[model samples]
Target: MNADGDETPEAAYRLLHERAVGQSPTPGERSLSAAQYDSARADYLAEKRIVAKPGVAIWPPTSQTLMKRLGNGSWSTAMTSLGLTTNSGRTRGTGSFSDDDYRSAVAEFLDAAADGDNRSVTSDSFAQYIVWAKERTAAGAKRPSGAAVRQHFGSWEAAKTAAQA
Candidate 1:
């Protein structure tokens, strides 16, 4: 609760976390292949955005898939060189990364986007990230991963350091 009588939102967050990783599968909710789920979720989100009204609707891909897909992409260069993100994707985690950590993590995410994991993201939100990564690649920062870091280390920098060693 804040200084007022309002209840804190931590419970809602906990509930979401619980759902992300639960004990057993529900009746009809069989465990889905992460890739398939991600693809489907991307499609679903696209449908929502495209079918809606108002401004120039664009559903970017989820940062997870996009980051690994792009392969350190331009994020590392941008963050390291300019202390800013070149790609317009989520950089900060749940506030775990320091500024430097933020830069590294952002680099990792762009790396994914360049690689094209298309699977790192949850099935429910992708389109925009995919579109952004691909678009950026077309414009310049052409990065494309042969194999996703997540496929082995579950992310980019992990795969990079592992490959380095």
Candidate 2:
């Protein structure tokens, strides 16, 4: 029990985990995957971003702290060490993407659009590129979206210019 005495250790851990990941832990003996663990850590860090008090340091919790408090190892090693099962049944992308992937997808999309009847980038071209990029990406790999490309290059014309450059 904490100072408040109402929150049990399990409850406290659940609250933190839920806030960090936007969901509660899965029922039964299951552990998070490496990607999922990384995401949770990121969420925890994002949530912990607050103004520090005078003479008081506010540091985000680390994976080690979570491990110690949760009594479990990382998803990769937990299955062997703790005999826990993974909840991820199907392969899915982590949704974290790289700049290179975005740039490459944009280039590919522009090239395809040029080769097609439309020589210029339009909404249809962007949608086609998104489909092409998703098909080219491997299973469980993050795929680029039209919004991601726009965000990366500021606009479709800018993205086309960058690809040309």
Candidate 3:
């Protein structure tokens, strides 16, 4: 079922077809493989019955729409419930922060901090860095926590040094 509780066989088939094609689904008419058709049918049935009760596991819980509903409007919670993991051992909302992302954030933070002729990376500076990182990151990208930053660099001074490099 779609957001309005309307049956959407075409949408389901499109999802399956796209998964098979390893690409985003395109609009208009398209053919479906036998397996895609069968999977779409199952998905349709699952969608229809998903909200009948609580705690029912939805197969292919990776669907963003379904996750939003299942998470009670929090996509992060839905991802957590689905056991999503990251290399940093942080869950969703804690930031999908990678080393490269951390480095870039640090660089930006250092630049902003140095604008006032303050080269030191103090606690307040680190806090500001978090805000800067959050604001500059792309939409849907996770926002790293202070802890994540510290973990990445071992200390504020180290992060500052790397950023200056």
Candidate 4:
């Protein structure tokens, strides 16, 4: 893990995994805190110099780079390999909501979007709808996120087509 560039990517991932081990956040706290990420970044920079800035993102490039170097696939796949759970709530595969419920939500959002001149249901629009619905809709109803919906249908286009059906 020296700065000599001798440490393998697998070793880097193993280091991150070790840091995350038994680090479950309490209620109201994020799964992975900024401090943890920064700490990892410090260690990462110490070992291999790069231009990754210190901040947050939907998917941090620092993590993505390390994951790619390890030959893992997506972020979720990399996290699974490291035995880490993402901060996102239950995914479609986890049974957070039924398929019908998700399709209904998309259909309703599309109907609203169609009322205006814009009929295109892009990922951005769906994400905004999720935020609006979460604030306005009654409690206890699961609102699928843009990522979740996209993952459910494999793409925004697929989701729109399924919702229309």
Candidate 5:
């Protein structure tokens, strides 16, 4: 539509759609909207936390009573709907980290890390794990079960080296 326009040559309107619709416009000119915007948001959210898919209706983590009730439900129902199931056939002990429980804990840790709250990792649930891991890696922790505490040369050496560094 300029002064030299020949019958107003077709001016294709280029719209920055994706950015306006809450999407990163760093990629293309194709306007992102409708399901695209939703998918992008869903993917981003899923990375930061658990996401119940379209067919899956995972309940928000709450009381242990509700979790136990759901665990006793139909396998398919829990797997497809609430996103859970029990592996009765497994030889795992009664005291074990369930898949969902592990995932939930990991999600919690990630959330805490994202929020920069290192103290948030002090969960009673993972307290045992912390103790176990610390003991396993603790210097001079290994003993014959009845043996007395001894100063480990390795730990002393490591401490001296770190101090010099």
Candidate 6:
């Protein structure tokens, strides 16, 4: 019951969720995963606009904002309460990559970082490359973080040595 006495935004948002997922959500339940939410949101935004009143169109908030608002001030907290998986897969850390994989990623990053210059791949540079790679590639294809690489080989220099070996 907003100013117009219509369904509240959260309610309408839930209805959109229902329509998108082909199932109604139980009370206080979040039925859409973050990915599904993003897809549904994109579709909703793509559809023709519906004016809520005079100049205002009914619209949903961005995924992070929506989760925060609904989940009581924290996006992760809200997501957890709704039983949604929050793993972005692109999150940086020591992953399950094998030693060989680490060597390959290090080689690739070193080559890319070197480019036409003779710049050496410091831990900082490698970390920056990992960030850049994560953005352009799928989550599974992203390079491990520099810290992970160092941890895998026990040191940055050792990691580079292994890659060159």
CA lDDT of each candidate? 0.38, 0.56, 0.55, 0.58, 0.32, 0.62
Judging by lDDT against the true structure, name the best candidate. Answer: 6
| Model 1 score (lDDT) | 0.38
Over 1-165, each residue of candidate 2 has an lDDT whose tens digit, in order, gives 223554433444444456556776665556555456546556655666654468753333344544554545433334334444666554332346666666666776666666656544443356676666676565555567777787777886787777777
Of candidates 4 and 2, the better by lDDT = 4
Stretches > 4 Å off in candidate 3: 1-95, 116-124, 137-143
What lDDT, from 0 to 1, does candidate 2 have?
0.56
**For candidate 3, what is the TM-score?**
0.34
Candidate 1 Cα RMSD after full superposition onto the native fold (Å): 17.7
Off by over 4 Å in 4: 14-39, 42-61, 66-92, 116-141
Q: Residue 43 of candidate 5: its Cα lDDT?
A: 53
Which candidate ranks first by TM-score, i.e. highest? 4
**TM-scores, each model vs. reference:** 0.20, 0.34, 0.34, 0.52, 0.18, 0.43
Q: Give candidate 5 regions above 4 Å deviation.
A: 1-95, 119-165
RMSD of each: 17.7, 11.2, 12.6, 7.9, 22.0, 8.5
1-165: candidate 5 lDDT, tens digit per residue: 223342210110111123234443332233332244335445544655965567654322222222244434322222223332323443422224443433343343334434545553444233433443344336553211101011211332332233233
| Minimal lDDT window, size 10, model 4 | 25-34
Ranking by lDDT: 6, 4, 2, 3, 1, 5
State model 4's lDDT: 0.58
lDDT value, residue 148 of candidate 5: 9
Worst 10 residues of 2 by lDDT: 73-82
Poorest 10 consecutive residues of model 5 by lDDT? 7-16
- In model 1, which range of ten residues has the least summed lDDT? 8-17
**4 versus 5: better lDDT goes to:** 4
